[model samples]
Target: MRKMHVWDENNLIDISEVDRNKVINPMLVFSIKRDGTKKCRLVARGDQQDLSTYSKDRQQDTINNMALMTVLAVALDHNLIIKQLDISSAYLYADLKEEIYIRAPPHIKQKDKVLRLNKSLYGLKQSGANWQKTIKDYLKGKCELEEMRFWPCVFTKGKFLEIIVCLFVDDIVIAGNNVNTINQFITDLQNRFDTRIVNDGSPNERDAVRYDILGIDVEYKKGVSMKFGMLESLTKKLPLLGVEFKKESRYNIVPGTPNRSLNQDLDIPCDKDYNAKVNWIQRAIGLSNYVAMKYRFDIAYYTNILAQHQLYPSDAVLFETERLLQYLWTTRGKRLVWKRNEKETSELIGLTDASHAKGLKYKSQAGYFCIWNGKKLFARSTRTSYVCESSTQSETYAASECLAISRSINYLLSTLTGKKPDQILLTDNTALINSIKGTKTINLDPDIMI
Candidate 1:
């Protein structure tokens, strides 16, 4: 292990970073590779994910949502954001191929301590791998899966009908521009897995989690949560479990979670000097939740940094995340707005931020945002953006990063959003901006990278 101190370190970099194509998911890769032989090598490998890991004095989800509300506000108006909310079962364990072993839970019932593997558990190592396999297989060639720093895991077919699907364990959130396409996608999905149809008209009203996040009540459930029925009835062409994605909304998922130790500390960041840093963290968290809403993949860097302080962020950290959350709450009613124009075009906008000498570690923070349909998202990823150096050095290095991401987004602008390669970026450093645009004479040497 490396000796790294968070407070005394001289190098601080944004912690979110990821390789979009690799899909580090073990569940998807650990499938039965049938090549005329029986069971081939297990393609997936990773430790199990524990939701309990999120249980702590700090509420990362709440923080992130608060940030998301802001972006959603500016991008969308009083209407337009909608979803097909539905829940078939509480949660189902995923089926697996390998026999990876595991010890029993600390306090749960122990039928047998070291049990074998037949399916995935809340904390199984290959659980995500299996889920990824299923999702990728379902999406294979329809959408574009970006592997670069700009956008990852985005599926598109030249914008005829765009769909953004985010798979989070058992909860799947799919946002699409068209209702016909979304319903068709759901029907096809139900054919593949044991999915409970959502938004069908045969049942009593709406599904739960429609206008709510965890327990915080959302404002626009009709358009955002209850819009699933439009797709359900429209896609009646393909029949699944007796009806289209059924139209039943439930609002009873807020009493308690499997774990209830949350909200112990709102833990507001109370310092005055870190206001800028606080704002940066807020934007990062908001962008992260936005990434979950849209299928954009460039936000891994910022969200990861905000996540580090999930347990107990200082006044410098918590306020930043809170700022972002306020943003999300405002925008929660919005969706990735896409309209078909006679010009046959779309545009992609991006933003990047880097701070030096600001962190307790004296490290720099780097964050970037990718906009699809003017709907913003900081990609959800396992990586974070972090670099150690002086403020000047950190800003310059972050500028280069900003340029790299801009170039990648420029490529996707034509491919995904249908607009020209022109992008707008916002940053606090004028020197970095000038350096990136090549309009100012700034030192950009590799040896001097922070």
Candidate 2:
């Protein structure tokens, strides 16, 4: 805080001068990194402040997972150098909009005085928005980068330099064909804000770029493929969740069995230990959902099922959760590999499927995956909002949802690249395909058509 001059120490005043409600208590948070490094941050109890005082546009946008993956595929196709960076004290660089007061920290030796903030601080409701605006202005104005219309967190430099920069809060991933241009951009960023490269080794010594972002480990192969996985993270978390491996001859080939009915209603145990069990089940489901979303699409369906029962999970649900974790542990080496596909033409390819009336409430389960350059860009497994009367109707509903998401992905691709690529959606249901081809008539809800 002293280095950034986050606040003026001389401006401290008595509490009577400021509204007591506006004054927030300061908090210090500390954590240990994987490398055994300790870090601390001073934050404010922003929750105590009046909600009406916050700006309606305080929520900041980050690059979506689909767009991030698409960019990585493009980078792999072009053999672009991928590097990562972290902005030191990122939120502290932004100027605070609202008038806020904080009680002095214990080490400051001024217990009676309240300090006025000049810049954004951690834990503030609008801190993210303020930091986003700060970085966006610097990139657009100082760095001369153009922000993508569809993805505000993505920026590119055209004409002379072919570079792309993606922002996920404080972390930055830069991809470009020109090494000198990328280095120069990094230099400019460092000059503007205190920053450090997140790449594992020194640039000269680094053979292949490797780093972790958003809990996903990313590695760039020279001309092969970009590999993404969560093995290391999952390995560390499994023991904490009580997932154990025993000497067994056989292991689960799949995350869950298709024949097993995960949606069956089971009585929740009324024992005193039920709450603790429920919490453990929820935690396991949460971790599984993260892994499924980022790296493993195979577990997506089962993880979604476990998530639905998180509120009141039965012993059977807990057992299912453990099985999913065991499957993950058994196949921890599996990763999503984005290989360079020479014949890949389209920017986005979609495949969708539906399970008719699979849930206890008679709701259909819909799942869809979007692909780029023959690699999976993103996938989603969700239950439909309304129950469908037939399998065809459920399939049609799933297709509609997939089409909506594909349009957004298409728009993002078009904005990034000058030309929009053709989209092809595959479905197994013949009736739905025939309806689209005008060969057969199938009654679909007007809302679904829209």
In model 1, the worst 10-residue window by lDDT is 1-10
Q: Write the per-residue lDDT of candidate 1 for residues 355-385, one digit (tens) a residue.
A: 5544434455555565544544333222225
lDDT per residue (tens digit) for residues 337-362 in model 2: 88886664655677999999987588
Instruction: Please name the candidate that would achieve the greatest TM-score relative to the true structure.
Output: 2
Q: Highest lDDT: which candidate? A: 2
lDDT of 1: 0.40
lDDT for position 286 in model 1: 55
Off by over 4 Å in 2: 200-207, 247-251, 266-270, 439-450
Q: What does candidate 2 score on TM?
A: 0.91
